[model samples]
Target: MGVDLRRWWFDRQRLRGDLLWGVAGIVLVLAATLGGTLALTALFPGLAPVGEVGADPSPTVAADAASGLAVNLLLGWFFGFAIAAFQEETLFRGFLQNLLQERYGRLVAIVGQAGVFALAHFGYYPVSAWPLLLVVFLVGIVTGWLVDRRGTLLPAGIAHGFVG
Candidate 1:
């Protein structure tokens, strides 16, 4: 949540207290992925494999994200961080990472996990599918880079939460 975004977003957030910078990173990455994919694959090419399916956003997922944020924020210093920080950082940043890195080289492992994060977008909408996956994949790379540079997961999770 605290580092490595393009200067436009970062500079403004810096004035506000570095929180928005977290958000900026996510936005920037998503934009990058979408821009890149649209440039290379066109908009509808991935529709068959991913877009032609799915409709509703799961109530369970919505509930989890909402309740998760509520619980974590209220219980701050513990659960707030545990939910907002720990779950994403350890699970997305560490667990999925371990599995991926073991089976593939570090860069590929990171890219694969990013793809999985992107794939989760299928739960949203068909037309939104490719862009969502592309965004998340890019996000994964930035987060992994943050983790590597900071040697901590909390910051990355902060960015993820704010972006969502």
Candidate 2:
């Protein structure tokens, strides 16, 4: 089946459920990312991430940090919350995962979508930064599960905005 735009929209009737799940998703993502990184650091003391998270500033924001910080921060916040949030959830969970689910099954869909989600971060982290990728993969798995459980992208999108 093709992507159902209706399914991708937030169900106002389930706003409470979506918000609750979104909070849970946030906690899960943080736990996965932080815990995984800590565990890896313990195992490999010398492990170093290729780039620090939130280090790369957008071109417009970077152009003039002296004054753009405030404005760019607001813009960035909106961009993350409004655009990236919905876009990513719709793509990864609403579309890709459902596609995989139809052909492979729920478990495979969650895992397969998670694989793609982690790989999508290649732009930020190189192959050498496997630890971060591992953490991201775990985050993907949890978020994918959240979407599956909730049957909506709102929760994951909210979590993504917070985590982004």
Candidate 3:
């Protein structure tokens, strides 16, 4: 409520910028995730796939992965923009984060938004995966920070959609 509404405006230029930034952010995150997975497997040799030690590249697996990526890319954009990203970002970052920012500042607002975002996931899902909850929380932090930096939800929304 205390934040300036003008800063959140989404004109044509801002939309283009948001799309670029969103893609950039997701690409960086993906690269980091891939690197981390590689490092983890290296550190824990036992964690490698069963019977996959020193195995040659599998064309079938590669094809399957490519197909899956194609499907996921389409679904991600649809769900992210149409449902998940737009709605969740609006509520958590647009409303809650902005409300908290006025009183508690950016750090608290971002964290608080992220905490609530994680809790929402925890409640919606039936799984007992605590690590997933942490991942959701981290996502919230990233998206919230995006909103703060851009003063709009488009970048985070686009990124969220891609991540989905």
Candidate 4:
């Protein structure tokens, strides 16, 4: 049987409520990410490497970010709201986590999905960026927890979008 889009953790009747919760989730995740990064840096000073090669963006990227603020804004909004929030939550929290929770249980599913989520970023980041990976994994756990608690992907998606 094909998937029922109507039953995919989306409630049209609760759109306003979900949007409010989504905003709150975004703020919460932003604060958590910043605080967590600072805390980790304080605890492990070595994690903050100095004078890394290719750490800075290329001149082209910098120029684009500087001159194309409007374009960047639109693209960022689209990716954050549509791709990261909607698509990722649908895949990770709505489908994968639900299936795992059904087979293995909530705790295992949450952690397992989180690990997978973090690992999925391995190709994008360098291996030396362990602290970033840790933060990503923690965020995944928090997002998964939000989905489990709310029985919806809206807040999780919003939070994930903000994190991205």
Best model per TM-score? 4
Clashes of 1: 2
For 18-78, candidate 3 gives per-residue lDDT tens digits of: 7777887686545544555566566655554424445586556776899888898888789
Worst ten in a row by lDDT for model 4: 49-58
lDDT rank order: 2, 4, 3, 1
Ranking by TM-score: 4, 2, 3, 1
Residue-level lDDT of model 1, residues 1-164, one tens digit each, is 44332331224434444454445555655566557566546656754434346565445676589988887666664553446455655766666765677788677767766777667555654664545566556767887665544444544666665544
lDDT of 3 at 7: 52
The candidate, 2 or 3, that scores higher on TM-score is 2
Tens-place lDDT per residue, model 4, 1-164, is 57664566668887677677777777777776777788888978877443363568545676567768888777887798777778777887888898899999999889988888888777665666576777777788888888887777877877777667
The parts of candidate 4 lying over 4 Å away from their true place are: 49-67
Tell me the TM-score of model 3: 0.68
Provide the lowest-lDDT 10-residue window in model 2.
53-62
Candidate 4 has an lDDT of 0.77
Show model 1 residue runs off by greater than 4 Å.
1-86, 127-129
* TM-score to native of every candidate shown: 0.49, 0.80, 0.68, 0.81
Cand. 1 Cα-lDDT? 0.58
Model 2 clashing-pair count: 0
